[model samples]
Target: MSFSKIFGGKKKEQAPSTGEAIQRLRQTEEMLNKKQDFLEKKITEELKTARNKGTKDKRAALNALKRKKRLEKQLQQIDGTLSTIEFQREALENANTNSEVLKTMGYAAKALKNAHQHLDVDDVHDLMDDISESMDVSNEISEAISTQPAFDTVDEDELLAELEELEQEELDEKLLDVGPSVSDRLPDVPSEAPAHREKAKKVDDDDDMAELAAWAS
Candidate 1:
């Protein structure tokens, strides 16, 4: 029978063979490894050139060093990617059955997704640095605000006025307690009555003296 007729007269859709998938992953890993190797070599060559140039063109040398550093960072990332791919391929190969293979594949896919989603170390460091600086600035602002002087509602003039009024009230209360009222003023003294009494007494004394003298003579 023809191959199609034997399989219900239709060509069945085939799943990717595990061996083929592992081979493809290995090929991709090898390519990444080659890229990483190239970048490393380029970085090493640039560093050597920078060192040989010495301090003559310091700015150029510094820029070359920076470029080398960037290349090295990229190389490291490529190496990590290759290693992860190789690991995943090995894991897929070791799965016992189809179900296990599927599970492993799913896990590998999820891990790749997560790797893509994760922030780079440099980004995380920069974010943390920014947050720290912001906190420091906020603290400084708060301290400055706390140290600033507060506004006073009553000034010196107003305070002195209130004090003067209180003193005046106290003095008035004391004067009222110590001083006499209008009804308690001294009474008027007798002057004419004393003169009249002296005159009357002198007249009586003169009459008595006359009578006595007449009798003696």
Candidate 2:
């Protein structure tokens, strides 16, 4: 019932967005195109009427031609207006596309800047060099530890002399053992020869005793 509730309370209409403006322009263009087609048909009909009238109806033909001219002027004005609207719409669309492209490029630049915030070319190079040096040092240390210790090198002539001395000592011991074995075998042979002579003397005594016994018998 109050004035504020009746009028002042109403919300103000929002401005049309670019999209809405473009839509309206397209609609106007379509309407204008339909009107153009209608005008063209009317012009054709008027032409037919003027031609058929010839001199039989001069005033009616003149009036039809005049109407046709007026419709053509109106059609021309609509075409110009449609062209203006289309130009404005296309301009707005190009501006919008450019704006979006610039915004995306700005975001990409910001992300790239953030990514490079903690990186330094010098530091990266130094780090790689340090890693490579450490690996080389580790390899050298491993090789040093794994390598076998070298034994003392002996002279070839000294080794040959020592081997010959060992051979000569073994040969002398074998010769001394051979001397004891051969003497043992020779003593056994002489004892067997004395036993054989004693047995032969005993056999000769038995034969003499048997011959004396036979003579006494």
Off by over 4 Å in 2: 1-13, 113-217
- Report clash pairs, candidate 2: none
My TM-score estimates for the predictions, one after another, are: 0.37, 0.50
Location of the lowest summed lDDT over 10 successive residues in candidate 1: 145-154
lDDT of 2 by residue, 131-171 (tens): 99999999999999988767755689999999999999999
Off by over 4 Å in 1: 1-15, 96-217
- Candidate 1 versus the native: TM-score? 0.37
lDDT (0-100) at residue 58 of candidate 1? 87
TM-score of 2: 0.50
Clash count list over all predictions = 0, 0
Estimate every model's Cα lDDT from 0 to 1.
0.86, 0.88
